[model samples]
Target: MDELDEVLPPEVTATLTEQLAGWADGAVTLAPRIGVALVLLGLTALVAWMAGQVLTRLGRRTRLRRNLVDVLRLVSNTAIWLTGLLIAVTVVFPTITPGRALTTLGLGSVAIGFAFKDTFENFLAGILILLREPFRIDDTIECEGAEGRVEAITIRDTHIRQTDGQLVVVPNAQLFHNPVTVRTDQQFRRASIICGVAYGEDVDEARAVIEKAVRAVDLVRDDVRDIQVFAHAFGASSIDFEVTWWTGSLPVDIRASRDQVVAAVKRALDEAGIEIPFPYRTLTVNAPVPIRSVDGQG
Candidate 1:
């Protein structure tokens, strides 16, 4: 140890020399302590990798993993890699005292923290999101005025894919503090379409047609919810009715429901000969007959 002290930094080498005695001699060969530490670190790395694989298998049985399996796989992989890194550090420097370790780590840690502040914040937010589960991975959520399916949640952000073939990434912290709508979790969501008919058309006939159309859809709920047909307004062009139906719309998959129901109702009305009234404009024209009077006299 005394001889080895010559090769090390003054502060650390003196401490190491006093503890190890002849174990770290001036020999060009490696010491048993170092060799053992290396072996332990290697074992830990292998174990960590194995644990990651096990986690992937275990996560499959979980609901979110079943729903967002890819995200779960990624999280497990990250955890294993982090554990392996920490084990490597601990094994390489076994006798580092608490105070000495802190002193050595001080500046580097501060710099690292500053550089990764946003990243760390995002990671912490992701953990909270997983734990709290405000919404699941496949849930239809509304954030920042955009609606979409939650594709994935990572350390820095949450991903969503909208109907328009756009992918949106939201910061993790915003999720913790903002209001989000989870529509997919519900058994059904109420959808309403406003339509207007000519004032002279029978409101009762229109209502009946709409109800029949809504009930015909296989996805519409039959109980605890029903079709709503009510006179919503009396406009200058026509009378309006609000047609509402409860449907098991997939989380973030609303366009399908909207298009299907609207199309069905429109077809039903067309079959029933119910007019979807349009605005009207009246025109009047007057022509002078003085030119015809001369021809009649001739």
Candidate 2:
């Protein structure tokens, strides 16, 4: 150490020591600023959360649609956080002017938008969905081969609870771009079933029986319209009748009504001696040739 110190000039060593001391002093001075920045960030997050809660509660109190309420809450929360972030940045860097900050943000946003194109696409789609409300929460919807009730809608995805109890998270872009079928959009939905009877049984009689049977189901609604029964097609085994009825739009209602209709139809057909025939196949063999003795043996 003494040899290296002797090789170096006294002036250079003194300059290096002074620079190290300045750096240490600068670090000490900046520590408080960094701490204040962290505190500002925490406060910003807290304020954003509080704003979200208030907006959500207020939205719920109004008559606004659920999706619209969520959207409003989201927008308000975002605005609050953005304001907080700007303030925190200004506090941290006292010399950065707001105009310069905005300009920098504008440039940064373009790069971020390109980098996260799909994410931004879903976000925009989600906002539009919340604004337009194609389907509401708990609405039964079919889209992209996934049939389920909407559980929740968020900025990036929609949560759907399937009939088999599976939860699916679908991107908002897919929902917005594709066609969705809302099965429970109306109060009543049409339920149809095909029933077949033996060809000998009268088609008109079968139709009458089916109409009566389906109408008798408690879940089936008869006040709006009468049940419709029509001869749909001649099947391989039995003549088919397409019976249509109005029922509650829910899946459970449709299933229960169908069960009742099927039971009632079976009972009515049995009582009336109308046979629901199964497919029957007939095979015939021509008279077999007389057996001949092998090797010319009679």
Model 1 ranges off by over 4 Å: 1-33, 50-95, 102-107, 201-205, 217-219, 251-275, 283-298
The sequence of per-residue lDDT tens digits that candidate 2 reaches over residues 78-176 is: 777777677777777778867788889889999999999999999999999987888889999999998888999887899999989999999999999
Query: Candidate 2: which pairs clash?
Result: none
Top lDDT prediction, candidate number: 2
Candidates in order have lDDT scores of 0.73, 0.85
- Cα error, residue 93 of model 2, in Å, equals 5.0
